[model samples]
Target: MASSAASVLNRLLQNASRPKKPSQPPPSPSLILHHINSNNFAAAFSALFSIPTPLSIPLYSRLLRISASTRSLVDARHLESHIISTHHPRHPPTFLLNRTIETYAACGSLRDARELFDEMPRRNGGTWNAIISAYASAGHSHDAILLFSRMNKSGSSRPNDVSFACALGSCADLLALLLARQIHCLVLKYGFAKNVILSTSVVDVYGKCGIMSDARKVFDEMRERNAVSWNVIVRRYLEMNEGEEAVILFFTMIVDGVRPLNFTVSNALVACSDVSALKEGCQIHGIAVKLGFDGDHVVENSLMEMYAKNGLLEDARKLFDDSTSRDVVSWTSIISGYALCGRFAEAEKLFDSMPERNVVSWNAMLAGYVRCLCWGKALDFIFLMAKESEEMDNVSLKLILNVCAGVSDLELGKQVHGFVFRHGFCSNIFIGNALVDMYGKCGNLRSAELWFLSMASNRDKISWNALISGYTRHGRSEEALNAFGEMQWETTPNEFTCSTALAACANIFVLRHGKQIHAHMIRNDFNMDVIIQGALVDMYCKCRSIEYAINVFEQATSKDIILWNSMIMGCAYNGRGEFGLELFEMMLKDGTKADNVTFIAILLACITEGYVDLGHRYFNLMSDEFGIIPRVEHYECMIELLGKHGFMVELEDFIERMPFEPTTPMWMRIFDCCREHSYARLGERAERWINESNPLNPVEFNVCSGPAMEPS
Candidate 1:
């Protein structure tokens, strides 16, 4: 069969090069058309070229239709060349010439179509639409838009619905919202706004541009809509991460009794997955089954992803096991589920056993390792993936950068940055943000700032967040605040920006900056979420504004454990232990569950207030009631509590009974307490421990446990 195909192709090439006289008189146009209708285009083309008579424009136009239907570039080229050679058209040949252009475009030779279009003696509306549609269909969006604008300026012809639809499609591709609006007004001016096809195109462009308000307005005003219209709006919402809106539209479509398409079900499922709305996802699944689309490949894949992302992994795994139509997407969906759940061992086994792997599948396993925080393993697997040369996409690159940030692997991050540049991914805003985050996290703020500045035009909120968070992480609080200020010039800061900026303010005691950010949030209605409330409390407390901290803490309509913990710790730091203890008791009475962090704050209060007995009781409650393990910080607080009260024997005994070796900070805390109480014996032990633990202990010191004062 291979050899036979080779022989046939050789003959076709030979025929293309040499024109032999038809051994018989040129077949009648009817007979030649019979060959074309039978799809014997080669024979039909040869006979048409051999015709001895000049053809009518109608006959030539009919022949161009057949060639367009064939979608054969070679046949289209031959037909055009033969027509050019015959020079058969008399005057105003635009009708037949327009079809030749359409035929050339349909055959995927826009270059040839364009040249012919430009050479036309005179072009009509049909001629302009044909070329515009050709450019639109070929994905030459900019050129299509340019030509569409030219058509209006040249006044060569008035554009009908078809021409507007083509130009609107180009605007959709480029996300040219302003241009789309202009075309939309023209659509109204030309009295084509009611045409369903043209109306649908306007809706599609508005949706793709992410102007949902306009999209909905147009849709509501539509005298009619098809399934394509419904699908476009829902899909655009999902793409823009407006999942709730997508789901609302999906339900609206159903209530309108528009029979759900397979893709409609798929889009609804995607919305459900994104928002983790499991109930809605299951509803869509049932809809698919009811519509007999349950067996559809796309719906089944969407179901798998939906179930996995919503934490129904067992259901997803069961579906994967029962599915007979497993493709790369099916496998990847299941693997990503396992990764999301932090079950890397199972994810890896399934990934290795899959019959085929694409970049998505590879990224799934790599992401699993990163999500599980197995950084070293993730680093190793990425290197393994490099061996396969799986074309790393932005998702994979971001995951790898995340691993670099996780382990603070600057060298590896630089290598991946090179890979991003080599593959022309640096211009992608998401990847650029990831690069900034990676460099910032690796403690290289200069590189992060440089990258941020370089992408000045494209940077979004996430980009500014990355640089601000990086500065805060490395103790460059002033820089972090400055970046936040500058960010206001380009883009408004969101919760993440405010959170980090507040932290920087807290670090440097910049109460003025913290207050300004708070006012800005109020003005923007940034909706003082729980995280913001917590940061506000910590910031005020750190800046020695206890009254303001208390005011914000009490005014919060709802308080989570983190907010309670922050207020309590702030009180302890500012010598307000009594008030902090009162807040803790109120927290318990409020039925807020205290975790390990809450216990840490309470213990700090105990240490500051010198409540020796209360500190011991809370330490016991950590294990007895809350099942919280007593971490080293809790133990250090206990030592300080005992030493400050001059319970020297108990402090010594407590240190001896500790479950683990004390850290340097613990020894230093014990040393400070013992020096204040003039307890020499314990002070000596702490000095030796500090020296052994951190050989570089640099503070000039002696047993400032000061000479032992005789007991009373």
Candidate 2:
């Protein structure tokens, strides 16, 4: 029965083909629209638009109108099917198929666009233009340029203004200036210089490629302009960090009645923050709010970032709180603001309260902890992330590794090393650099060297800095200097490299080598770096050149807390005890809050001068007013001061009340004092301490009884 039915249909088809007059291709539009409406769009679009050579624009427009209405109903699979049905057969005209592909490209369905591109039967200028624009829009400029070359070779359809414009856009995306100029010449040959869209695209391309003069020439010649034309110049100024120029362009755009988009306001606000024009930022803020763009995420994020950068944390926090829906960036901005303000505990609390956590969130928290010297907790989070198999990105690993280096936890550091090794991240440059730092901080310079050698690539400046710093930290100053010389022979030393080597020179008292590094720093214009300057100051002081140290300290253009500490401590350590005292008092008067290290330096200065009363007063003030409890070093200072004043009885009482066990050095000082003063009663007490410190060295009574030093 089925064979009979097929025979009947074949007979009817044969008779219809033999003597049928042309009937306008059976009104393919109506049939195609029906098929498109009934969800048989693939078959309908293919049949209606399958006239091979020059595709009709009117028919293509009709099909596009229908497709545009059902855009939300289109899925990825439907787009893929359309590309397949149109390109695989020689039926669809190149222009119509290309037009349909443009829709998919605009919708960001590059995968579908590529599928159609690969299947095209007869490619032409329109087809190549469609593919090139898709690739450039999707940020695959290399692919776009490659496709344009293939299209030029085809020579089927001549390149037009759209073709050259699209190709130039690709080159701009790639930042290929040479290629863009070549395409601009092609645009001129096509006489499309008068095309407004093409001209503006050229301006945009040149502006993005940093050829601002050429972009401006093109812009000035344009008799017609649009929003995009203004944005090109505005963004150009913003890129140059010329906030004033960008503001002028924005005003011109607005006065010209070109309605500013959300992106335009966002870019201008970013420029304001770049130049730290806080007043300009606040004015732009009001404009964005009035324009109803304040609630937009991109605008809000930029505003928050602007306020944060300008040190307006309160305003940033208020903007963040005003947002009804806060994303990870919102939380990171506020938390990072706290970190910038030195409110580490508050930053930690905000980090904990965040409902969502991303790598940025973790990085902000880790940086905060590192700043607070809570490196142990920072490392804990790093390990926790590893244990949970969360994405351990290169940045997070580097941050944690730096914290590991700071605290010098060898065991925990080794565990992280094991994780890096297992995860195949050991070869990553950043991870490798951080690993060098971790091993160095753990006091395993050899291990650090091993890791350094294992890196598969040449080391960057950071890698060199880590290794040099490791050697310096381990008291291998000679080796560190050797590495520094080698580094200079191979690569240019950055400020950090010079600073790390200077720190080593300070540690080893290599005054000559340190001076050479200082010379190099000055030559490179890095003498102004506060860290490098501070390090040089410290180096000179450690080498006992207080005059040179003072010169470096005084020459600093700006001073941070570290600079103040370095100068004060250097003065205290280099026999300039009086100067150190004067600097400390000046620092206090200047409103530089004295940290624990500051107090320690000043107290040591007083101890050196035998101003026992003043030392005690500072200690009491640090404890009571500043909330700095005495640590072991502070207690040692008190003990030494008391012993120096011949107060053996009081020194004993002070040592007894210490929160930690007194080291042998602390006890030996008391014993020496007792012996010097001929205090027989205190001598007996000191002897007991020495015996207790060394159980094997038993005290023996002699005809002139005295304490033995040690066992034979």
Off by over 4 Å in 1: 1-25, 54-66, 82-92, 555-558, 586-592, 661-665, 684-712
lDDT per residue as tens, model 1, 569-683 = 9999888998999999999999999999988889889888888899899999999988998887788778878877878778878989998877887888878877777777777
lDDT of 2 by residue, 1-712 (tens): 9999999999999998897686664444556567766877567655653433322466455556556455522643443355445554556566766866776776667877788778777777778888888887778888888887777777776777766777787887788888888878878886888888888888888888878889889988988878777877788878866778788777777778887778888888778777888888898898888889988998898898789878898899899888998999889978876875567777778877988888777777677677677766777866676665476677777777778778877887787778788888876898888899889888899998888877735577777888898898889988898989987766788888888898889888999999998888778776467888888888999999999999988887777778888888888787788888898877778787888888878777887778887887888899899888888788778877877776666666676777787777777776766666555565667678788878897553222334533223
TM-score of each: 0.90, 0.70
TM-score of 2: 0.70
lDDT of 1 at 682: 73
Against the unseen true structure, what C-alpha lDDT does each candidate score? 0.88, 0.77
